[model samples]
Target: MNIEPTILDAVNKWLTPAFDAKTQEEVNELMTTAPKELEDSFYKDLEFGTGGMRGVMGVGDNRINKYTLGKNTQGLSNYLHEVFPNQEIKVVIAYDCRHNSDTLAKIVADVFSANGIKVYLFSELRPTPELSFALKHLKCQCGIVLTASHNPPEYNGYKVYWQDGGQIVPPEDAAIINAIEKLNYDQIKFAAQDNLIEYINTEIDNAFIKSSIENASFNTPQSAKDELEIVFTSLHGTSIKSIPAVLETAGYKNVHIVPEQAEPNGDFPTVKSPNPEEPEALTMALALAEKTNADIVVGTDPDCDRLGVAVRNNDGKMILLNGNQTMVLMTSFLLKEWKKAGKLNGKQFVGSTIVSTPMIMELASSYGVECKVGLTGFKWIAKMIKDFPELEFIGGGEESFGFMVGDAVRDKDAVAATLLICEVAAQAKAKGSSVYQELQQLYVENGFYKEYLVSLTKKGMEGLQEINQMMVDLRENPMKEINGQRVIMVEDYQSSTALNLLTQEVSDLTFPKSNVLIYYTEDGSKICARPSGTEPKIKFYISVNAAIENVSEITEAEAFLDQKIASIISEMQLK
Candidate 1:
């Protein structure tokens, strides 16, 4: 095959002495026989999004491999040098249990070392949140973790963090991207110099676990522990090692592990995807929970940052609580316990995303603690914590099954979440209330906040264009009513404007500009439309709330909420 000139040049460059021989042969084979695929692979560089770099694993400009990972690291290191020139620059690097993760971590360490930055590299696999916490605890200038998180087996990612221990945001994010964009084929440094890089091991691990236990909710009277039998799963990701240790160290006994899914593998052998938010991913754990007469089932993703739990409701059937429900349940339980222990000072507050369950806000307000809403990411929540130094952060969560308690880490920590949930379960046992019963009590106090998240994947260039067209159509012809409900207000975040459609008034939105549109109906229904930043998908978030007079009506309320969601989806043709 006659390859394109540009692709041929890229292949030749890969064959250079600076590049690995194995990578060179792979590129050569693709160039000689699969010219089209080669071009597609090397046509453009992988992008660093609002989070960080994520893509398919392969050797090319557009994929996640040693060379590309090196480039991203070099750029980040250069930016760190520029940002902290004349001062010591340090960074923490961690990786998950994915294929080549250890190698990638080593490569990143080499790049940081080559650039005159001190690197605190994890000696073994760790969760994404640990890296975030390490950034803060170690006082590093920046941090990186080689993890694809909940992505498919063939995918891997690199997340960049700032000194605040949150993922990089704003001017720094743009600056890092600018640095990454300037690299050419020959500019990235990939050579390894042994002394420049340092590998961190159990010292940090013990410290992190100690911190997890210190931050755990252990206020329950010691007598309550015997009644709690909790089942936990790691979903064949990174939590197989740490979650159990944290639970045992937190004084919770009788914890059962799902033996079938106990091992950590990048393929995520037992589940379709490592994401615990999906009920399908928790099938094995749920079954084990039922067999053991367990009170709850908790699972973490590959990187062990996000967590999902399935609880046996009053009906004795296992029901998976959505992300919103989980946060509401956890937050309400934590706050109640904190108050009981006399820890609810006036300065304590909670954080959640703008699209998370409104019940959190109501719960916080009723407790006389402020509830702050970030744009949509945990990093923003971390930023809020940094912004308000006077406020003591109780806990914060996103609806994606990610929650963080305590300020020990600036990001979500499933290990911390797991320990706390078990403690909460034990506390509930003392009160003769299961976690499910606590959820019902929360609804009795706060209004019922039902949420639905619908994601539509649109792949390739044409699919992206189609998604854009749908957004444009919606903007051009605004809807006045949906599913027989009148829309009272419309908020277009991309334009930073909110329209009072009823009064024909317009006002500027205070938040940063984003490609999101939100509609509020007269009947307390809220709908949000946002295009996914990292993937080929658009997500619709629906939140509907109503008063609940009694816990027995939860089933009818849930059914009513489901029907409402169905009508909205049908009216919007979102399927």
Candidate 2:
């Protein structure tokens, strides 16, 4: 393989004595046997995007290694010192079950401690949301979690959280990235100050569990909780540390955990992908639910930031609810509860992402609560809470198998979400109705909306170029029709403008600039395309809606929407 001059310079730099002997040996071996891998790894530096940083673990400037993560930590420490001048800088650190997460967490702690910053490190693996809670609970200026979220086993990452208990956003993210870029590998502080580093466990765990139960509970009768049969799986992730305990403490007596997946393992042996959004990840949980005749099943990804759920349908079959379906059920139920308690005083709001189902807007409008939409990632939802503190945040989620109950934890908390979802199911069972039945009734009342997501993975340097080119083509060409439906509006987030197809008029959209495009059709169908910031993939989200006045029409409405989505995919040559 032919390598670029710049890439060859990077490779030679790694071969120098500046990198340790083992890293030098590893790079030399790759240069001899795997020239392509060597070129790919040195083509560009890993970017610290707006959503933190994630990449495969290997020896490269583009990979997640000690040098990369250490640089991030060192830069973060400097930024915190500058921001809180003359103050004692304190930062918390947490890690999940992914390979080397523990070691990575310690290295990060070492950097902070070595730089004269106080550090609070978790003694063992913990949920990502708990890290968010701990940062705020300890009054730390910043926090970090070492986990790749739901990505493949080969990947790992670092996510930085601020004092607001949310991921870094906007100006801070830019500032931190700038600091990281201005430094070299030798500037990272790897030495540790034992006195400045503290290992924390039970104190934060108890407080987090208590807050979870309090936020998730809705005054459901204890009798209903006792009757609700529950099945939960952590997918060999971190939620096993707290979810089951929280459920048991909250009056839930009949919780059945999948024994095979109860243990935390980084390999994620039982599933191809540890993500809860995949049906195969929940296969064992579903089987257990069937065997126990459970009312609901829940599964969490490796980081426990998101969740997947399955409920009993009317025909006695276990139906897996997609992320949007679960979001609808959770949001609508919360809105109803708030109304029942006369808490809908127009000073509250719900949150969602642009790629999520429009049903959230409908539900929020019907309840007279404002629906705030942002770009993808829960960080933006967290930003909503901080940017508008005057308005109370009830609850919010996106169509990615994640939800947050209340504002205690700025990020998504599957542990709290698990208990809240079960409460919904338990109450439905108490009223002689099931969650599926309530969902169908919701469709009957406020139109039926179906959402579908398609992600195409493109790996390596060449693949990244291909993904970017595809986005450029879509942005410039602008599809005029799909499945015989007329495209009426084109919203380009990169340009922060909306163009009307028929009138040829342009207007500004109130959204942050990004490489995302949305096409709206006359039939109320919305299609969105955006590339993954942290992964080598591009995602397309499709949403179609139609009115349904009776429960019996659900089956037909769903089939029609499914057909429509399929046709749109084919017409757009997505396959």
Candidate 3:
């Protein structure tokens, strides 16, 4: 295979300047052994999507490398210079436990420093949210974290933030992408003054840990920590270094690490993807939990932005709770405790994504605290907090295991999430009730809401065509029934209209236009289909609800609901 003419130009440019000898060597090796791979790597540049740059880690225009990182930093620097020309600007940078994550951070730091911006670089790998928190804490002009979140080990990413500490959106996001598009190899500066870059590690780490612990409901003594036996695994990610320390500092004595996954290996040796939402990812932790008779097993992803937990149910089987279940448990626990402590001064509210379980809304309504539903992203939740100053944000999470407990961070903070989850477990134990028990009680009070998400990946240009066709099919031939129940209403978010099909009436959606579609059935079922904004996949979210009289009825009700949803999925040919 021959390198495309355009790709050869990029390769020649990289080999000549800025990039190092090792990168050139790697590129030459790929050119020799896998010319096609080299072409794929160099034919197109890694894009700055709604998030930021993310792709396989390698030495090419399409890959995540020093050049790409440097270019992105240069673009952001240029944008910041124009946005706040007269102001002395500071930027925060953090990395995770991924391959070349630290190196990428250095590249970003060098570019920012070269552009005359002060950089606060973390001395070691840390969670992503802390970068967001540090952005606001230091009042920096911008922030970036070198992480791919829960993506596979072969991947690395860069997430950009504005002065508000939230992910870039709308005009700013488009402006940044435009700047990046204007960049070339010669335009990115790499030389840096050592003094302009500050190394931050334990000092900030300690402060972040204390802040997270302080947000918890209670701090148990080491002696009483046995009341909650937590089996936690970092899954060869950054949390292995910080989570246990944070939990121990929060007075949890019985926190055990899955030995196979305790080390920070970018390979993520134990699991297929190292994502906690996947049951297979928790196999090792679950096995250890059963052997140790642990009360709960939790795992954080590679970057530690998202968290996954498995708890012992009433039937004595360990089951992983979906993202929705976790949010419901954590949100209700936080609000209930706040109300009990007389801290709920009527201005407190919680938020979640639109596709998240309606259980959160019901739970919030039960306590008289408002629950705001934004589109599917943690940044939107953060935006809500930034928009509403009078309303204190209690906590917000999505169904994908990402959560943020306080206004300390704009993105999901796994460090804070880990601490708060353990605290919730401890508080439940102190009440002589299990976390599972609390979930059951909440479900009884509010309707039993269950949700399932299916993600279908379409690769290459051909896959993109198929995805577009599928969306077209859904919009043109909307489902009239799901699981034998009639769909009463259809909400087309892209058109910003909600129509009562039977009544032939239409209304408006309060949210902005997005490419999401929702169908609500009379039998209390909601089905949502949307294409991912950042990835090459279209996701379907199915939510169903039922009534449960007691804990004993949970198993049967769950089974019935599962059957109902499975039938609908089959009918829709989602699989």
List, residue by residue over 16-130, the lDDT tens digit for candidate 2: 7667899989999998999988887888998865457888888989989988899899888889889999999999999999999999999999999999999999999999999
**Which has the higher lDDT value, candidate number 1 or candidate number 2?**
2
Q: For candidate 2, what is the total of clashing residue pairs?
A: 0
Q: Please list the residue runs of candidate 2 whose C-alpha ends up more than 4 Å from where it truly belongs after superposition.
A: none
Candidate closest to the true structure, highest lDDT:
2
**Candidate 3 residue-wise lDDT, 1-575, digit = tens:** 76668878987887875668898899889878988778778777787653566788888888888888888889889999999989999999999888888888998999899999999999888878778878887889899999887778888899988788888876788898888889887788988877899998887777777777776535454455668889999988888767898888777888889998888888887799888888899999999998889988889998788899888788778988989998899898888778878888779889998899988998999899999999888878888987899899999988989888878777787888887778777767777787788899887889788899999999655666899899898889988888899999999988999989889799999886778999999998999998876667899999999988777788788898999889989999999
RMSD of 1: 2.3
Model 1: residue 475 alpha-carbon error in angstroms: 2.4
Global Cα RMSD, each model: 2.3, 0.9, 2.6
- For residues 1-575, could you state the per-residue lDDT of candidate 1 as single tens digits? 56667766766777887777889898888777777678667766678764577878888887899889888888888888887889989889999989989988998898888887888888889888778878888889899999888888988899988998888877788888889888865677776666767788787878888998888756665577777888999888888768888877777787899998888888888999889977899999888987899988899999998899888778788888888887887788778768978988788999998778878899999899899887777887888888899889999998988899888888888998888888777877787778888888888889888999999999655667888998998788989998898999999988989999989999998876778888999998999888776666888899987789999888899899889999999999999
* TM-score between model 1 and native: 0.95
Candidate 1, poorest ten consecutive residues by summed lDDT: 216-225
In what order do the candidates fall by lDDT, top score first?
A: 2, 3, 1
